[model samples]
Target: MLRYQVVESFLSINGEGKRAGQLAVFLRFAGCNLKCSYCDTMWANQPDVAYTWMTKEEIYEIVRQSGAKNVTITGGEPLLQKGMKELLAFLAEDESLTIEIETNGSVDLTPYLSISDRVVMTMDYKLPGSGMEDRMNLSNLKKLRTVDTVKFVSGSREDLIRAVQIMEEYTLRGRCACYLSPVFGRIEPVEMVEFMKERQLTGVNLQIQMHKVIWDPEMKGV
Candidate 1:
């Protein structure tokens, strides 16, 4: 009888991270713990937003219908949902499916550790531009593995400085794959690349939001 507050679920090519251009089923959960300045999905956190309350079986059926081998569970902070453990547990049954969750890195990841081997956590380390960087649970960085990814959405040169500091502090490159992406239309990818080159920053990749390029930047759902 457990149900998840789902804002929307659709099949789309992953627009970011290491999986960019990969077809996957995305489940956008409702609600969030922080309000970032550039959040495109603020509507997902609004109390009055329209959403479907779906049970595990219902969610599984949707994924089955998508016929995608990869599933991305994103949010307004998916960890805020009560039934995520159950939903993840259900999804884990499909050994052939690769499940990934995108979190704001402010929530405790321990709850999902049991299935760590099966689930990949794309933890976004919020930067100064987000205005919610203080809320980041630094300990979560220790939970990462090579299978997971840690990302920084840089909105300015200052933000990349913070990312570099953290990257060195945690030796994140050796811990897991680290990615640096310019905030859509705010910071340019070329600028980030130059910065990395000048500093001889190693082990961090420059990524772009491929979905925004393939479709109208303003378009939602693939």
Candidate 2:
């Protein structure tokens, strides 16, 4: 049986991405390859973290019962898990669902691209503040489509500047949904807006984690 190390699963509004503010089923998987300085889900990334082993059928049933059309497969770093493509393929069988895979910048996305037309990607572009910038797979940027998203979680002005440079270099604005999100308390939204205006970074959206605002920042399971 194919099983996944699931840290948590819940129904909630997508706090980020193009589907932000819309209700979605979140499947948070366990483990990650890189440690970001601003990672809020560090508790779920620990080597010995408590997790439930779930088959793809079990996971699909949870989403089916949630009555949500949008599904977000997030993680400490979702792509690191084995059988991820198979799991995604299973989920994709439900044509009515919109599956969004949230991946840290390190992993290669090419392997999962053919899984389904309904599967979209929300990849991160870790900045210097994350301390995992060098681990980013730059090639993944080219793979993003208009339906996909590239999120830049900025903690400092330097990070914001680097984000703009990368966006320009990759011509990301027209290629996909580019988002600049503040690292919770590190940088303010107004500050990010100002930076965007100053740089004339047109077409990029500034997103705030709505779940953190609706509930406690540390709260789990929505």
Candidate 3:
């Protein structure tokens, strides 16, 4: 089995995106293909941190002991891992468990779509301020199933405008929910909500980092 840079394994509330506040065991994989400027998880992208490499069996044992009915496959970029698929398959043995994955909205997830029926994909679409617009997989947006969702984190009026325009331009599937999240402290959630209302942007919803607002924003592992 290939080695995995296991960042942290702890039982915590799912802080953002879907399944928020649900009991979850997060697998924060280390390493990302794109470097977004607003990325709060920039720590995971670094290469120097100490990591533990474990096989699928070892990971399952840890997850079982955690007593978490939900699992969120997060990262720097969990999909970047070579055996991520195999690991997901192994976890699928637990029928009642809900699996979720957070991606940068740049990788090809078609491969995992078939096996991960219960997996809710929280895909982050890069806005202009993110400095990674070119890295986006536009095709991946169209390929997303109803279970998959697209998210755009806006830092300014320009960023929000672009996000709405792109969704309309691509004729993004109506089945997918369009998530518009602010840059936390950088952008006001109320202002963002008002903008969406004034523009009458259909298929749009607001998202805030609940854990950040309720707990220590600087903390990690829930």
Candidate 4:
């Protein structure tokens, strides 16, 4: 049986991207390659990752338990798991489920492209302040489609500058749906809007954590 760090499994609203507030089953896998300063899921960082190893049949039972029509494979970095392909292949048997993955954009995601017709990939594009900018593969940005959304968590005006530069260089503002999110309570959403207006950026949206409003900002799940 393949081992996987099943960090957390629960039902909740997506809270981000184009599908905000949609009910879904979130399978937060454990382990990450990038150590971004503002990572909300930093509790996943460990000296030795811990996980619940399960066979594909066992995995199906868990999703079957969730009673959710949508499923999101998130991480510490779900792509880090080699068995992720197997998981997706198994899940694809459920014809009614809409599967999506939230990736940090540091990995080659080609293998996952075939899993679902509605794979809403949400890419977290690390900025200068995230301390992992160099790890980003520029080619992936070009491959990202309109169905995919890119999220940028801005911590400062300098971070915004770097984000805008990357957007322009790749024509990201026009190519796909882009999201500008202020680190919760750090940068102001109003400030983000003004900056976007000043730059005349198109396809850029301001995203807020919707679950934060319904539940406590510190609350883990619904």
C-alpha local distance difference test of each model:
0.90, 0.92, 0.84, 0.81
Candidate 4 whole-model C-alpha lDDT, 0 to 1: 0.81
Candidate 4 displacement at residue 65 in angstroms: 2.2
Pick the TM-score winner: 2
Candidate 3 TM-score versus the reference:
0.94
TM-score preference between candidates 2 and 3, better one: 2
Which of the predicted structures, 1 or 2, would earn the higher TM-score when compared with the native?
2
TM-score of candidate 2 against the unseen true structure? 0.98
Say which candidate scores most in lDDT. Answer: 2
In every candidate, how many clashes are there? Answer: 0, 0, 0, 0
Please provide, for model 1 over 1-222, each residue's C-alpha lDDT reduced to its tens digit, 9 standing for 90 to 100: 788888899999999877888999999999999999888888789989889999999999999999998999998999899978888988999998889999999999988978747788899999999999999999998888888899999999999999999998888987898999888889888899999998788878888888888888777777
Instruction: Estimate TM-scores for all models.
Output: 0.97, 0.98, 0.94, 0.92
Off by more than 4 A, model 4:
48-50
**Candidate 3: tens digits of C-alpha lDDT, residues 1-222:** 666778887788887766777889888888999999888888878888657888888888888998988888888889999988888887887887878889998888887888867876888889999999999888787777777778899998999999988888876638676789889778888889889899987678788888888878888877
* Residue 28 in model 1: lDDT: 94
Cα misplacement distance, residue 200 of candidate 2 (Å): 1.1
True-vs-predicted CA distance for residue 182, candidate 1, Å: 0.7
